[model samples]
Target: MRTMLVADDDPHIRSLLRQVLTGEGYQVLEAADGLEARERLEAAPVDLAILDVMMPGLDGLELCRIIRDTYDIPIILLTARQQLSDKEQGFLQGTDDYVTKPFEPEELLFRIKALFRRYDVPSLDKIRIGRVLIDRRNYEITAGDETLLLPVKEFELLAQLAQYPGRLFSRSELIERVWGLDYEGDDRTVDVHIKRLRQRFAEHDGSFRIRTIRGIGYKLEAGNA
Candidate 1:
């Protein structure tokens, strides 16, 4: 089932959303505030997010920007405000759609379906190396029974390598693929993230290893499980 997050400060609103979303067969996750919503996202991935604009602590626009920078998912902003500036800000922050308050549940459901169709939702791109499972759909890695969520860049870097085990990738390629072709940062950024990934997985049983190709780049190889 596709998972959707509904974040709002009002309990009644959250409850109503949960009902409407669940009735449509989408699994619903809720957060009472913006910060809690962020925590929920980091711990578990959702296919789409519906965020209230007036949320306390890390409000919707800021949260939308943060999520957009990290995950490839659709976001819809819900607000009572009808100001054109508010709508513009939401779009600038990367919201896929904006829904005004007191909307018909049916209308919201129709919008949700349209977004799903547009984005081609429900695809899982996953790779397995020994006991490790890299799930691109959820932006999560599972090693045996433990699930780990890495920083967005770290996860993307690792996912790229895991997708083609034993295939070498140059720093330039990695930066282009993971950090985007427009990134203007130092190439050593890859080196720093790779180091962190190594440290993060050092304690796990040998299910996979990322090997540096000295002067060239890196590759992922299946290890003893």
Candidate 2:
């Protein structure tokens, strides 16, 4: 069974998430704040985390940075702030997805399911495409002697493309598989992440490329095949 940790200062939010996740067949762990959540994470591994932005100490952003630095677990941030800058910051800080405070529970559940379906435990250890090595367990990507630290979305998008080399995926399809079908963002986000991934690969003298299908979308080229 997959385990999920819910960290929120609001008792109401914690209870609601627990009820919904439990019904969806997930083992739920609850924490009232960032400090408590950190302790829980240290004691046991969780497949995903639902973090609230406003907390007594550490804060969701800080906690997320710590989690990203320490573990490869997926994170979905919950915040009342609806600013684009806030969302971008969360994504840049290694959050896999973001949910606004007045969110639909079903949307959150859908995102969780989407993430699990794509990057479950069985595929979490390592993913290799030609000479490019993605250590999903450690969140490290290596091409020959150079290792690259990818942001969360970049890693997820690359992993999805790697799963089926040479298979094209439209922007909508990539958004559905990687950012969740219910994600409320523009398709431009996918393009931005792909651009970043290509830059990282180039820095390491790696030619493992994501092919653009012009009006369609993208595909991972078989660099060694």
Candidate 2, 138-196: lDDT as tens digits: 87888877788888889989988876555556787789878996899999998999988
Model 2 root-mean-square deviation: 15.3
Misplaced by over 4 Å in model 2 are 121-225
- lDDT, candidate 2, residue 33? 95
Give me the overall lDDT of model 2: 0.83
**Clash pairs detected, candidate 2:** none
lDDT score of residue 1 within candidate 1 = 67
**TM-score to true structure, per model:** 0.57, 0.55
Residues 27-111 of candidate 1 have per-residue lDDT tens digits of 9999988999998776554779999999899899999998887566789999999999999999999999999998998999999
